[model samples]
Target: MKVLITGAAGFIGHALIKQLSATAEHVVGIDNINDYYDVELKHARLRDLEGIGNFTFIRADLVDAEVLNQIFATHRFDCVINLAAQAGVRYSLDNPKAYVQSNVVGFLNILEACRNFAVPKLLYASSSSVYGLSKDVPFSTRQSVDCPISLYAATKKANELMAHTYSHLYGIQTIGLRFFTVYGPWGRPDMAMFKFTKAILEGKPIDVYNHGQLSRDFTYIDDIISGVMRLLEKDGLEANSVFNIGHGSPVSLMDFIRAVESATGMTANCNYLPMQPGDVEQTWADTQGLFDAVGYTPSVKVAEGAARFVEWYRAYYKI
Candidate 1:
């Protein structure tokens, strides 16, 4: 199968492409390689995929409609996976335009291309942040995600709505995976997992948001890839569907820090801080819907996942 995966250099996108290419699928990946965190890290991800025979990488921004359209025209991909977006809740507070341009305008271009090209299946990444401000434990796809606290969450919620419209109007099978706190090797540096690990290793105090009161589902990257692969391989899914791809077990901020410390064999100096803007106290996902459809659920626990990430971090940095 010929597949097109956007955000090729991203945490999830990089891992997904590696797995798909290993299966001998002709996978084309595209990324703008924006200086959101570290451009060299993004380059490193692309470099790692260099020797794969079935993989191809293109450097392009999603908002460039002409380039994206040309790609669709040339490839006529059997499946399109749209993983590109302006991520981070706190970053969205100061730079709301980035979220609108990348998540809103860029996504519109992707939907248009899929509609015009008549692509049969399109799977896109959504986020657990969409469940903002709802006291709802184990946020399910059935619940109303009408109230979003951050511009980031608002854009993701908008993606689901836009996808539903296209699926109804154009008969495209659109699947939205609401990923929860995805982390592991090649994880984004802006995320808690990477940040905490970096600080702890360097003997710096790790900032604990919400005064150390936050909790997250903390789904591992490998399990996320497995879930996505299951959906891609399965047939006859609903034309418009969204699933909460998560570990289904929420890990507390303190517990997560402890796991990091255990993995690194160093105590973390915690710096307690009030909640930042566009941040939530907790995120828990009801993954039953995903399991029902894909026959898979995220299985990695935080302790094991943290150890694996630290191992990679040490080796990659030669720390």
Candidate 2:
């Protein structure tokens, strides 16, 4: 199958593209190369896929309809794995327009391309943040996610809705994967793991949000890639069906911080602060739908994953 994966420069995107290119029949990637994070990190990820034979890369923004249209016409991708979007919940509060531009308008272009080109399935990134302020312990796909705390979460929910509309009206197959806190080597600098690692290495203090009382379903990058590949193998079922791609384990912020500190052989000076307005106190995924559909299971334990990530972080950053 000819597959087109968006956000090829991102952490998850790089892993997904590499895994699929190595294992699957054919794969093509696209990214706008935005400077939301360090563009160098993005390019570095692309460099990793440099010599792989089955992988192809295209540099363009998803919001550019002309480029999207031309590429869709050129590739005629059988399946589209969209991981592109302007990320960061806190950043969304400062610039809500970026969220709408990338998550909503960008997604619309892709959906239209899928309909026009007759693409079969679209596996896109949704977020656990959409379950904002809900009292639910373990987030289920069937749970209500109407109260989004930030523009970022709101746009992610909008993407799911947009995909569903295309699916219902155009008979397109759409699957939205509600990703938990995804992390590992090749992760974005904006993520907690990456930031904490960098700060600890430089002997800087790290901000402890929710006063270290928060919990997150921290998923390893390998686990996330595995779930995505499995979902791609299966056909899309309904218009608005969302699946949680996670380990079904929620780790406390302090516990997670300790793991990071242990992996790097350094102690962190944390400054406790109130939970930000746009942030959720906890996030845990109910992976029943993913397992039922794709037999999804995560193998990496949080501690072990952190160690591996630290090792990679040290090597990659030359620390």
| lDDT winner | 1
Candidate 2 contains a number of clashing pairs equal to 0
lDDT of 2 by residue, 1-319 (tens): 9999999999899998878886667788999998898999899999999998988899989889999999999988889999999999999988889888999999999999999999988889999989998887789988888889899999999998888889889988888989999999988899999999999999999999979989999999999989988877766455557899988999999999999999999999999998887988889999988899889999988899899989999999898
* Model 1 ranges with Cα > 4 A deviation: none
List the candidates' TM-scores in order: 0.99, 0.98
lDDT value, residue 147 of candidate 1: 94
The number of clashing residue pairs in each candidate reads 0, 0
RMSD of model 1, in Å?
Answer: 0.7
Location of the lowest summed lDDT over 10 successive residues in candidate 2: 232-241
Q: Which ten residues in a row have the lowest lDDT in candidate 1?
A: 17-26
Steric clash pairs (candidate 1): none
